[model samples]
Target: MYTLSLEVVNKCNLNCSYCYLGEKKNTSMSIDTAKKAIEIAVHEVQKQYDKTLVIYFIGGEPLIAFNVIYEIVAYTKSRCMEMNLKYMFSITTNGTLLTKKIIDFFIKDKFEIKLSLDGSQEVHDLNRKDYQNVGSFLTIINKLKLLRKYEKESDKKVSYAHVVTKNNYQHFEKNFQFLIDLGAERVETGIDYYCTWNNDEMKGLGIQIVNVFALYKNQVQIEKKRIYWNLLEHYLEMYLTTCNFYACKAGLNSMFVAVNGKIYTCIELPEFQIGSIMEGLNIQRIREIAYVEDKLSESCINCKYKSICKTRGCQASNYEIHRNIYEPVEVKCRMTKVFLNLIENNFTSQQLENLKIREDR
Candidate 1:
């Protein structure tokens, strides 16, 4: 479950409206810094007795710094082999820069590719526009077509990183169906916490989730499609485990390495530097990040749904808006309550029991 996210470059070709990184720098991670990052990351995972290490490529668009990724993968493979560890590589791209050579490399390496596509063209173009303010839907969908052709050649399946914004929340159903039709094996839809949300918009989004999950339920029950959606997975996990798992595991199970070689718990929280590749992780800061939830505001801790709530919000998001991770995002807390309540009202008790039985089987 441990992940090392490398912000390969601080540059991106697109100027998406809701980019959480705020501003992009022209910096890229030097091979030396990357190697040092690998060394420390491998050491951390090993010390914990974990056999797997997920070396994730993230950025202003990781493909822009693809050469760094190529070199890092080679070095990591060597180190992992020596340590008798299993290594995984994954990248999230905007899908405007696919080429045969790149696709070939991805296939050969068995990369877990996630395309940062927001859904249908109209809805996508709303925010995910290139520097020229042109919609990137056509470019991405075309690239996706090429990727899918390669997908048939191997067992690798493509997943999507869907971003929901206040502007596009209403179109989520259509956008999600479009991706499903385009043969997405998995979709991890996350809200655009960079933007502000009004109470009405938040409620509308909750309604969208309830409606979408109804479709999701039908797909699971009637068609038996094996597609995975993150929200549904979280809901099911909450039901089965009765554990209020937080939305993010940054400080506890993950670390994000920025292009400057500084380490943070997440890409969004640039200010929360836990350490650097040169200095190594600050155990105290990491431990504080791991336990940030327990130190939430008194109101959040004593909320009626605190024990069952799944939307404790992300540390990065909380810090981005509130300048403090412990201060919960009102919209996130409210949406969690609304979505779960709407879901409870939507599904019959027998259906819930049936879902539990089916999931267990």
Candidate 2:
């Protein structure tokens, strides 16, 4: 129950209007239905979990079925190495069919590519365009500047995701210092949850992302940081943040297997309905009671970040934008008090001792 997701193919080339697998969902699964949906999700996480299993590979563009994702990562690493288990893999690709034989099969089978660059290139070609309106942001920023000038996998690392909209929130710090000068060790950025960040164009992109972190307060460099403020860094580190449906273990830690073999709980909640690695990944027979009452709303039960938030904020964007799973809406709480009031006015004291020595290495 340490994560399992495999939407092997919902088939996407590009047409991002906040895709809810809708812009012609061509669906795909068969490679013997993705090896029997990874043998019923590794036999239901080895019959109710022990640990060490992390598979992600999600899509409408998981490299559009790159050979059924290289035969489900070589048969889920040869059946989780004959059941001694332990396999980790990740993918969220939109790096325009990254090639060099898909970056040498994501550097000899160890993938962690998250790429979905949403800034600059005129704010990511105005919302990742292409349905003949063309603009895959200069073909994914010239394939992330040709994978930072052909990085022949020196122990792989390439992360970048920029969403924050309202037309790129007044150049969100010159689009995150132009993807940290396009080398991008890490850069998440987020906030454009299908538009409307308390508009006036998102309070002018929340005062231009809090005045470019108060004008690069101490020449910005938070050591490759940016998990788009994962819920304001879990309310600034453990002031409370927990999930997996508040511990009922949302079908064990996390699972999303879509693209026709159907299974979901995260892929932004794929419109609530769950269950179907052909019909037995069974979260008590998911016919979808909005993820069986883990549901929230009344603006998340009168938000104060609802007991440290997480009820449902993305099940495939809650059925394509408020088709209703109670309507919580997200824009990262309209720029989390303007990026924590510009990190408490430029966090100095030698920039918090160089941000705690770059967050302790």
User: Scored by CA lDDT, what does every candidate get?
Assistant: 0.81, 0.65
Give the lDDT of residue 201 in candidate 1: 93
Best by lDDT: 1
lDDT score for candidate 2 against the true structure: 0.65
Q: Sum up the clashes in candidate 1.
A: 0
Total clashing residue pairs per candidate?
0, 6
What's the distance in Å from true for residue 268, model 2? 5.7
Candidate 1: residue 155 Cα off by (Å): 0.8
TM-score of each predicted structure versus truth: 0.90, 0.31
Error of 2 at 302 (Å): 35
Q: Model 2, residue 152: what's the lDDT?
A: 53
In candidate 1, what are the lDDT values of residues 328-361, reduced to their tens digit? 7877777667656655777788878888787776
Clashing residue pairs, backbone N/CA/C < 3 A, model 1: none
Instruction: Rate residue 181 of model 2 by lDDT.
Output: 67
Weakest ten-residue segment in model 2 by summed lDDT = 232-241
